[model samples]
Target: MKSKSFKRYFILLYPFLMLITLVLVALISNISLNDILMAAAKPLTSPFYRLSFIKEFLIVGLLSVAMNLSLSMGEMNFSLEGIFHMAVFLSALVAIYFANFFIIIVLVPIVLYFLWQVPKKVSRGDGNKLIISSLIFNYLILGAINYLVYTFFSDENISSAVTKDFAFALDMKLGVAIAVASLVAFIIFAVKTSLVTKLKIIKDAPSILTSTGTEIKKEKRAIDLCLTLLTSVAAFLYLFLNYNRFSLQSFTGYGFDAITVTLLARGDFKKLAYPAILITYIRLLSLVMQTEFSFVSSVMYLMQGVLIFISILEARDDRNY
Candidate 1:
């Protein structure tokens, strides 16, 4: 009962907490209040800005959906950033020689194969172990990314060859459509399938299920594959939306943000959209800060760390509930 109350209160208080954090960050960074206000108001004040916000929202929104699938099943997939990056980079390479449609064709099988191979090496443990293993997997992907960057990819080749020849606004709209469909599919799967019940048991009482001859490991892998599948589609659409905007500099923090969004929404599919909008707005505000105040990315990361810590606490409380 106490756990339930605390979770409810925390969810209600989260937006205010984020608002306070932003204000504190602004004050500490010596940024102007007016600048922050203007940044917050941009999406509301302009159609182009609104559309741009929605475009960015779709990327992280779909990602949260994907990540939540694994997270709700007691997995924290830090490897999603690596998976998303790999998908975009490899597909962009294929795009150099083939049509965009062919990229989708190639991505699906590659993602499936990668997910298939992942469990062979990294045994799925509990949540913390899953996090550590995912991080390990992520770093491995990063190592490969570094080698590929050195050997194959560059701004000149990627930009001139892979980024053009596509309609940006059209692809953005297509991404939105696909994201809506994914949400519907997620709802049906949750409500209509027995997998949801099985996943709950797998998370809470794996031994009981195993005693009944349930395939716990197989069930977990199935969720992981579903996660990869959703993330792969999101990756391709994200690449289409921001084709020239990426680099091999570092893992884009979109994956981490997605996890945070899912946590903040408490893995509720209906609530996920709300936090996605808020997070995306906060993210855009951070970009504006970067330009206007020379705000450091590390500061934003620190704030996100706090949010994640709190959300993890809430997740723990949920287990108690």
Candidate 2:
């Protein structure tokens, strides 16, 4: 009986597993893996390069996993992209005015609270409602920024039109390092918290836990809030600090990448880390491919989105084992 049950479960999981394998194979084949490996193995490589890549991969993966976990608990937080852009704007503003680490740290939470609360208020506890409200919020904020940029910050003298003084103090390397450190600290704290532990129990025995009703609801809210706040902070740091370096020229592609990372991890942080790293590498590889072939990058994004959509649908239908 036990063997039959296990076999049945494996059969159900096979297609999903195969899909993941195929994505990996396709991504791997697109890049010059051997050449990249050889380049990395060179003795003259910079320490910053090695450390920054690991830091960036972990931070992005951590944020994606955190957001997915909040969504799993039915928290409507559709403001991630907006919050990310806001974080960049706020960071730039703060860095310009203050340029002190302590001030930025103090302000980050306050900014995140406002960002988190907007969706909570608008959604009135509905996830879909929150998503819609957040999307609207994103556009409104973007328009405001563009207006400000053009009216005051536009250097009539310079071609780019951006204010030179308004740039963020921290670059990609420092931003990624700070984000990775914060993620590590959050993971440590989360492990010690009662909410995650209680959720584990409830997840293990929903019927028994649901009998208590109030306790389960409280535990669920605690977990969702914690995850949402953490993810918001991480995304904010990534977008804010790196925005100037990477063109905010197109956010649609990055937004899709965020969705793919979230789906691939299935809201599990540990599993998310590996996939995040793989996805980042795939993206880097995609850049190389784009230089050689005009349409490969567009094809890569389409493939990623389709795979994630299928994965989410399949996960919804299958019972968690």
Candidate 3:
């Protein structure tokens, strides 16, 4: 009986053992275990550490949840990336031209609403159509940004270059205001989910609840929005806090990092916060590793990509026949 019990325990432990072995092999072959642990721990207290990655992670996670929710309802809309980039550009432009902190607080949701609504209406409930339309819209926004920057601020100093001074201003009061507003918005949404319609929707479609119509969904969305707003504010604030602020440059890599963290967390915003920090740490460590052990950094990215791919495949297989 004891032997049988031991065998059963071993069966249960098998997958964990495999995972540990894989991690050990990877570390032994490429990076030192100590270095990897240190790299992972660096985010906890990095001088450049900003809580904004948490916000970014939440935003991306919420967006992912929203997309999943819509898809479960038989609606396919993948225009979030486009909407997100557009929102960022528009917010930055607002900060540059008007410098009204409240404007961002008011405008972001409006922009997201329109971004969400247009394709939904045009597609008329066709998932594939909605996706294609969103893709086109994303390209259009990218083109517009290029044209606008080229036309109005074509001079190298004015156009392509970021004004160090202005960047600093964004990081200070303006950043703080954005963070506060985002937090408020998140709280309101979370409180409002107690309404009957949302509960009914959750009852009818549990999966949709996972994405949109549950108490948790509302909480998650609110958290994500708050996190994103805070991140944006913090990033801008960092510029102001430092006198050596550079030009207003978009960090697409950070955006992609947020997406990766969100994907890794599977849209659980609360759970995602810590992982987002880890991701940020990894990003910083990558810089150091790139200089010391170039190939390892590349391998880390490759491994992350593989993990994401495998996750998607497994999720799809589980969901479908």
Candidate 2: misplaced stretches above 4 Å? 1-52, 135-140, 150-163, 166-177, 198-247, 250-255, 289-296, 299-321
TM-score of 2: 0.64
Alpha-carbon runs more than 4 Å astray in model 3: 1-46, 49-78, 119-123, 126-140, 158-181, 195-250, 287-320
Q: Global lDDT for candidate 2?
A: 0.54
Which consecutive 10 residues in model 2 have the weakest lDDT in total?
245-254
Per-residue lDDT of candidate 3, residues 177-214 (tens digit): 65556556645664675422443354346476667534
The ten-residue window of minimal lDDT in model 1 covers: 160-169
Q: What are the RMSDs of all candidates, in order?
A: 3.8, 6.4, 8.1
* Candidate 2: tens digits of C-alpha lDDT, residues 194-306: 54556556555666776866476566656655555565556455545534432243333344455566655544455555556656655544443344433143555566646
RMSD versus native structure for model 1 = 3.8
